[model samples]
Target: MKQARLHFYAELKDFIAPNGQNKTIVHNFKHRTSIKDVIESYNVPHPEIDLIIVNNVSVDFNYIVQNSDDIHVHPANASIKQINIAPLRHLSPQVSGEPRFVVDVNLGRLARYLRLLGFDSLYCNNFDDKTIAEISSITQRIVLTRDRKLLHRKIINHGYFVRVETPKIQVREVLARFNMYSFFKPLTRCTFCNGKLKQTEKQNIAQRLKPLTKKHYEKFLVCSDCNHIYWQGSHSIRVARLIREFSKTDSPLS
Candidate 1:
């Protein structure tokens, strides 16, 4: 029987056995298996892997395991580059343009911040775990969650485990992780309903707003589905400032 050594780096290590901390696993096999399959067999998804190295050369998911080979796997958000493994599969490509996100119920604040940044972030406090998993799988939307177990779901292809606890930190963490500082599109989506906002004459929504709002704010946007009104209130400026602060941070994953 031939044996190989495997080492998972960064968040990839989260799936390894408790005793496997920063350590390599030795597995004996009679036939070769693709690196992707081996990794997924251990519960890590293909979408979360950014780099792989085998025997000191960059490799991809398709690389076949060989006897005595040393395999290293890195997560998409790790702050490292360059590994010694043959390139068998290229780095996984990120979703182009503004990446759409689906946040678990626990991440309501993060969802709001993502919306403030003009990303299509879908959030529902009432969604069950199964529903979230199904949405993530069917839409190919990136799943953002504080629950590590959610990201571990078998059906989820795109997912991220949020490490930050504070809402502000979480916003920065996501921005840095997705390299989305330059993609900010403010006020494009309804923060309340996750619906696209449409430009409307202030007079159209006069009755819906407070008496002061109707008289003071000229620019207005209304949700097509929920009819929620949005304006450049003091609250909007604060949210925008928070986004600007995050935009200055270096994206750890990019």
Candidate 2:
């Protein structure tokens, strides 16, 4: 077996085994092994890697490991000057128009929060890993999951391994990672069904509203798919506050 040394930089270190953290790792491998497989062997998902340098030269994922070669892996959002390096291959897809997502089964709350901000977040609690991967591949939707293994699928071109566990913090993490603060359009989507919301006249839906709702609110928004009515009731304050919080604390991309 041949041996090479790899150093994972920045947040990429978090994915590696504890003994290898913040240091160079001596990896023993076969002669023709690709760098992509080597990196994933350490639990660093390819989607999270932005650049790889082999012996001071930037290399792509398919670069074969050479015995005694030195490799450096950098995460997405890492600050690196690109003057002399090979063109960095950003693993994340070039998303045009509004960004869309297919959330994993366990990230239902994250999906709802994303939808609340008017982003197209498709989610179902019963979505198996294969189903989510298929949807992401077909729709070009970014996959959001806490499961690192799901991002390893070859068909998933755009995906993220969500590190934060709390839904509120997880949404902020995603916004920061994707630079999506400018895309916020609160209340323009149905949090329940990921449907677009359309303004509906109060008189048209008067029969559905409670007496107090009819008396107090003049404007309403209805989900195009689910037909769920929304008005600026007591919940609006909490929604507004949450929006403000998300806008302010996007945090830096890790």
Candidate 3:
């Protein structure tokens, strides 16, 4: 049997088995295969990987594995000092405008949280993988998904496999990853449909508001797409607190 030793570094280890973490993984195979296939077999999606070194030589995903090969895989956030490394496959796309995203169906809460912070996040509970991939490919929208396999599609150039499960922490994770602290525009978007919120005259929506809401709140914002109204009610306190919590610096990746 042909054998290769592989080591996954940093956050890339999250996809591998617990027993194989922080150490060498011995992969046994009878025939040669591309490095991409071998790594995906361990469940680490290609989008999460930035660098691969084979037997001390930099190589791309298409590099075919050889018998007795030694492979080292690094995540996108790895701090490698080598300038001569092979060009990475997952280069951050040069987005021309504000970063938009098409989230997976399983990450609906995360999508809502992102929209709450005014990011253009497209999410539908019924959206399938093909639909998400197509949107991402055509619009250059980044894909946020928990399913690693969803990112393996060849059409997906910009995507991230959300590591954390909690919606709040996942928001912080995404902001930290993308350096999006400056992009925070809380309460400027409709959390329900990911539409921009526009300031509307109180009398324009007076009939839609309840008696207490009409009397108590004079200023309001309405969704341009859905016409849903938003106001600074008591719930705003909790939202502010959550925003403050998300604004703090999260711990570094392993």
Candidate 4:
């Protein structure tokens, strides 16, 4: 039987069985198998994989594993540096354009912070894993979750496992992860409905707001969908300061 040896690097190692790191596993095969199928067979999603080197040569997902091949897999989230003469060193494109996100139920606070940054972040506690996965694929939005398993799911092509535990930390973590700090557009989107905010005359919404709110806050933005009201209140100031502070730090994703 034809056979090949496999090695996983960095975070890819975390998915391996006990004592799997740096340990070679000999896989015997009858016919050619795609590198993707071989890796996913071991539970690694193809999108999360950044590079694969086989027998000292780089290859993409379509590369067929041959007899006696030595394969090394690297995760997209890893920060490793390697010199390579292999052809498979291509990286997935860096995330560009306006940042958008969809958060799992566990990340409601992070959702709010992303909204505060004026990003279009969708969040609903009612969405099941299947719904979240579907929304992510259809919208091409990045999935934010604390559930590592969700990120590991085969159908989820764009997802990130937020490592931070606290809401504030998670906010910073996401900003750093996406390099979105410099792109922050404060109070640009409706926090309640993920709609773009539009400036409205204070008199137009006078009856909708509390008397005190109408009296003190003359500037207003209203959601086109839910008609929710927003102002640059004290909370907005605090959020802005926090985002500014995070922007100053060296991003972890960099």
Total clashes in model 1, counting residue pairs 3 or more apart in sequence or in different chains: 10
Best by the lDDT measure? 2
lDDT of 1 by residue, 1-254 (tens): 99888888877776677787677788778876887777777766666788887877777767888889888888875666454334445565567777888899999988987787788889999988889999989998999887756765767878887766888788887787788878878778888877888999987777788988877889988888798887889887777666667667654312
lDDT score for candidate 2 against the true structure: 0.86
Q: Candidate 4, residues 1-254: lDDT per residue as tens digits? A: 99889988876765677766668888888987988788877766665678788877778878888889999888775655563464457644356787778899999978987887788899988988888988988888888987766765656777877766888778887777677766888777777778888999988988888878877888998888788988878787776667676566754312
Misplaced by over 4 Å in model 1 are: 1-4, 14-20, 25-46, 51-69, 77-87, 91-93, 250-254
Indicate the residue-level lDDT of 133 in model 4: 89
Question: What TM-score quantifies how close candidate 4 is to the native fold?
Answer: 0.79
Task: Please say which candidate is ahead in lDDT: 2 or 4.
Answer: 2
- Consecutive 10-residue window with the lowest summed lDDT within model 1: 81-90
**Candidates sorted by lDDT, descending order?**
2, 3, 1, 4
What lDDT does candidate 4 reach at residue 64? 85
Top candidate, metric TM-score: 2
- Quality of model 1 by C-alpha lDDT: 0.78
Query: What local distance difference test score does each model get?
Result: 0.78, 0.86, 0.86, 0.77
RMSD of 2: 2.6
Across residues 35-119, which tens digit of lDDT does each residue of candidate 3 receive?
A: 9899999998887777788877778878999999999888876788763555544434555557789999998989998888889
Candidate 3 minimal-lDDT segment of 10 residues: 83-92
Candidate 3 RMSD to the real structure: 2.8
